[model samples]
Target: MPIFIDGHNMRGISPTDLEKIVNSPKDNFGITHLEVFYNESEDKLYCVLDAPDEESVWKHHESFGLKCEFITSVKQIKTAKDLKEEKFQILGEFASQLSHDLRNPLSIIKNSVDMMSIKYKDKLNADIFENFAKMDRSVIRMNMLISDVLNYARTQSLILEKYSISEIIQASLEGIKIPDGIKLVIPEHDFSLKCDGTKLQVVFYNLITNAIQSIGENNSGEIHILCMKKDDIIQIDVQNSGPPIPDEVLPKIFEPLFTTKDHGTGLGLPSCKNIIEQHHGIIRVKNNPTTFTILLPKDVEKLSSITV
Candidate 1:
């Protein structure tokens, strides 16, 4: 059996003593190799413990000598991008299976409902019909979200292709679900840049969606996009009207796993950064008291180095 051990989170054991416990026989039981995962801050180590059984696990954990919070696994156990990718492949396979399996049944229900409405419109109550229709819509949304998840996973998987900047922005607007009050204004201009078009679109969509989500329900706002060129460089600006992101948060926005929204994955902006860099361009965010602007600069020199 595979057992995970938290080396530092155990209570009632000194560091030296804990070493002795792990080194010697644990509770006079036959224990195989133990897996240890740990992170330390301010001289205290946060740890996660995985063991075979409740009895043996608890007994061994108590021997660590520190009052530790035992958990099955950590939320994110990565120190490098490569390790994260490996874990992503493992988990994403499971999600792909689940999404595929769910879609089959959902499609059947949708088909059945579509057929029934025509045959029995008079008998089916409006509320019941609405519920069925809503279910179909919800399932479709879930399918799209799952596809988004797959695209997200595959994007980080080191794939690259050539794409145009103009098409990407158009696709982004189409893919994004904007709130009623927020409007997106796209400019007409000749702006040409190269990138992984699909992933770049995701970045645009994420940024634009964030703009829409930032406005309060009662507040109205607008997002303006423009493509401009000066000499050899092309600039794409996505500006949104909303409360400015605080100064403190601005610096951290590009950092992976940093988010201002609840239930957000925190990958959107960083992913955008990565996509733009991959395509020989640089993406930046700027904000004023009531507006946020994302700038993408086209430069072969900087773009090549950052992507590598």
Candidate 2:
């Protein structure tokens, strides 16, 4: 679990009012309050808590009839960024180390399972084989999530190149299994983009996979893609005709380690945002048709003027 620092705006809040809520008996919400800060000039309260998820933090605040202005998950310390040239080095190092440590053991286990499957195929029953298949799938998913974490932590510069939009999209859809009856409309545009082709491929892949999953179990849906280039910038839109994302969840969808799915690492959108911003590009989502729009500059010289 990670620690989250949430901010709340309370008008005319007195010290006793804050103390009373802070001193209240703790419950089983799995929320531990570390500290609270009050700014007299602005009349804002900042609270830091350690909890398993954001919902628990919300419930902890509601337990005392307190209203929250907003809550966001905290990452590494920013104070170091002001003092040094690099930021989040310690945090990134920890994530990379942990990912490396986990990968070795997972690989060994997967190899062992494969060997057993081959050695005991005649003796193993159907139920045992099914469980083995499930394990292999879990291992593959875990490996993917580890790679996602490493990619998110990377602060390296981009290796930009000139590539066509059609080429990028085609490469991204290589192994993605789109369901039958699902229509994907990709316009034949002859636009060339100067960016990291591999990283951009990742962005499109995630958006496409999410669109495919958003369609119900029936797998009957339509995805519309539109691309345009003007004013020295290229914009790509991916829209899916499926259930719209919840209104409340739209704000927190890009936060790291925040997810609505049962088996998600919550790093997909965050990584996408990081990679795009590193290239001086912008990514946004809109409802009504559930579209993801990516805007990128055609030349690297304009990177300084573009604000991430």
Candidate 3:
């Protein structure tokens, strides 16, 4: 069995009532509530439990008419108290330092390429000029890879603010150069969401970039972004007219370091998943015409206050 820590907003629920609920018999899902922690001032409750999986924990909470803000899988450290730090924390620190070291040289190379391109444009042959262009692109690609690594390794704090869906999407599109043959359709019915706008921007940027790449250069295609609000959740779908992803590849698309592209770092989708999960939301994909759907809670209070 895996252990999970689930947080809930317990406003208006008394400690006595919560205890009575927790003491009730375990449900048929085989979930065992191991421990409970409550903060009266914050009206926050955290439950440590042993369960089959995250979904099982979700179902267990749903049965109690409670909504979990976030559910995280964790391991209990019984022996080494000093080694309680998470492996990802170490990896994040190392990745930050490594990115800093690598970017210094990368910046130099990029500047050199730009200067050479301007100084030799008239002197170089078409083939040589094309090679310079490729070099410049490679530098840009390397920079993006470094950013992906940092984004995945580090757990960033969300700076929540209210922003319209259309505003965020437009901000994401500013840096991307859509091909001439492709058409982008954005939703006219916009909804405002309180979230980490910068993180959500990264999610949209990666999804749109992937969509454009999937359509391929000089290929005519349409990428449509749709947004709708239903009940307490807001759903957004990014659909692209690209070839269907293979069945085997579909399941692993969000996995880290999994990619079919030769030059891809494979961190884009995984980073997007991490950001969505941090927001206490869900992201899924469907193929027939290749659509990625994201479901986010309309009420930001459902999200845990813990950064990332």
TM-score of each: 0.52, 0.58, 0.58
lDDT digits (tens) for residues 218-268 of candidate 2: 669999889998788888999999899999999998987778888777888
Where is model 1 more than 4 Å wrong at Cα? 1-166, 289-308
- Which structure among the candidates has the greatest lDDT? 3
Descending-TM-score candidate ranking = 2, 3, 1
lDDT of each residue in 1-308, candidate 3, tens digit only: 78898788887667666876578566547876557898778779988888888898877767767788898887762445445445546766787688868989999998998899899889999999878877876775666556667678754567788888899898777557788999999997999888888778778988998999999968999999999998667889999999999899999999777899997878899888887877778899999899999987765766443221
Determine the C-alpha RMSD for candidate 2 after optimal superposition of all C-alphas. Answer: 14.5
Query: Model 2: runs farther than 4 Å from truth?
Result: 1-91, 98-147
For each candidate, the alpha-carbon lDDT, in order, equals 0.61, 0.79, 0.81
Measured with C-alpha atoms, the lDDT of residue 299 in candidate 3 is 55
**Backbone clash count, each prediction separately:** 8, 0, 0
